[model samples]
Target: MEGTIKKLGQTEIYRGSRVHLVTETIQFPNGKRAEWELIQHPGAAAVIPVDADGKIIMVRQYRNATDGWTLEIPAGCLDHPGEDPLECACRELEEETGHQAKKMDFLYKFYSSIGICDEIIHIYVARDLVKTEQSLDEDEFVTVEHHSLDALLEMCFQGVIMDNKTISALLAYRYKYKL
Candidate 1:
């Protein structure tokens, strides 16, 4: 379906460390034209780390976007453009949770916002983990916690888990493991 649209041009709106904003003009298959505001991102990766005891490692961090602390799976943006998301997931899991997994598997990838943003977040499942020291970014303040899958499902049911990527990743984990 995307092949039906032809890009006309794009006007730069803003550029930042993480994202670039632009208004893109396009001509539809029907000859209609429109302008759409798009957010260009370098993408990101997240991991659901499960330990030997079957507890999932999670992170508690403050998000200015929500004006509060959020409980989410360990995640981080790609180091730079053209970086491997799998490597980002592996790096973020250890950096945030202080645990490195011996068995890491790809779960899925998703668009953060379909309408306006081009951010893609790759999700993974990490098991057989061994504890290491957490290496956080200067701007990051994260507290690592562990939870049972049942407890995480309850958090989602009660709306406590609000991050979309975390929610979807949890659901996928449940489906994958038949839990």
Candidate 2:
């Protein structure tokens, strides 16, 4: 069974330089129809940056949507229409954490919020870090934190870290690095 899109009634909530609002009407295979309000984002990139001693670099920031600050891996949205995900990940790691990775390995790609929006998040593991000045965006407010892979995994099990992308990244890191 497959659902088809019948009509899309998109109203521009805010025509900004980055994101836009779009709504659609989808007809399901069971003859059910529904409307989905989506914040059309150009996707994003998340980086699990590891330092020389193999500790992961993360960030703590306040998310307006969640109404509370959360601990998460370094991530940022695509700024250009055709920007490469890996490049975005590299940029975000540098901007948010003030570190650059000499080599970056791809981990996996997933959606941040699949129920309402279609934002694809690409995850990567960056190693061989070098410290530099953090270049944060004007609208972004964040602080960097470092954690061992073991401690991060513990946080995941303890429910202290509860973001999908972060969790996914951690799991991927575990399997990929054989941790």
Candidate 3:
């Protein structure tokens, strides 16, 4: 198990601000060899901001990859390498939603797309929100909205919420609070 796949070599395909693509040659357990293309990412943090009224703050933004607008929790990539995930969550919540959390609790961490990408997302539940000024990146255009937890759960089941991180965070929050 320890050496199930022996990495023979890897070639860098491309490196971008958020991801690094590479092709690797590996010898399988049965002595078969194959090449695999992998995407390396710096990871990210997402926050489910719940206000005192039990409504969750969400962001709607255009995603070029999907060619549509997506409803998701406030999230951002680990822009500063080696920065704390919780700090990133707080920053993203405020920057994207114009809200600051007085308390943030870690919910879960998972790979966004494990098949070919090595990007792990750390999710947190942010409570006791305070209104603040929103500060988004120059290229970012987002609309902040709030919905009840139950409504969001219904949206998840109805295919309204398509973002994986948003779905995961909402389900985790439901389980955590028995909602």
Compare the candidates by TM-score and give the number of the best one.
1
lDDT of 1 by residue, 1-179 (tens): 56588899999999999999999999998899999999999999999999888999999999999999999999999999999998999999989989898999999999999999999999999999999999999999999889998999899889898999999999999998898
- Model 2, 1-179: lDDT tens per residue? 55564663555566667778776776776667777788878999999998988889889998987898888999989887779999999999999999999999999998888886778999999998889989998978999989998999899889888888998899988998798
- The best candidate by lDDT is 1
Find the 10 residues in a row with the least total lDDT in model 3. Answer: 1-10
Task: Kindly report which residue stretches of model 3 are placed more than 4 angstroms away from their true locations once superposed.
Answer: 1-3
What are the models' TM-scores? 0.97, 0.87, 0.95
Q: Comparing candidate 1 with candidate 2, which one achieves the higher TM-score?
A: 1
Relative to the true structure, how large is the alpha-carbon lDDT of every model? Answer: 0.94, 0.87, 0.93
In model 2, where is the ten-residue run with the lowest total lDDT? 1-10
Q: Which stretches of candidate 2 lie over 4 Å from their true place?
A: 3-17, 28-33
Error of 1 at 168 (Å): 0.1
Ten-residue stretch with the least lDDT total in model 1: 1-10
Clashing pairs in 1: none
TM-score, structure 1 vs. true: 0.97
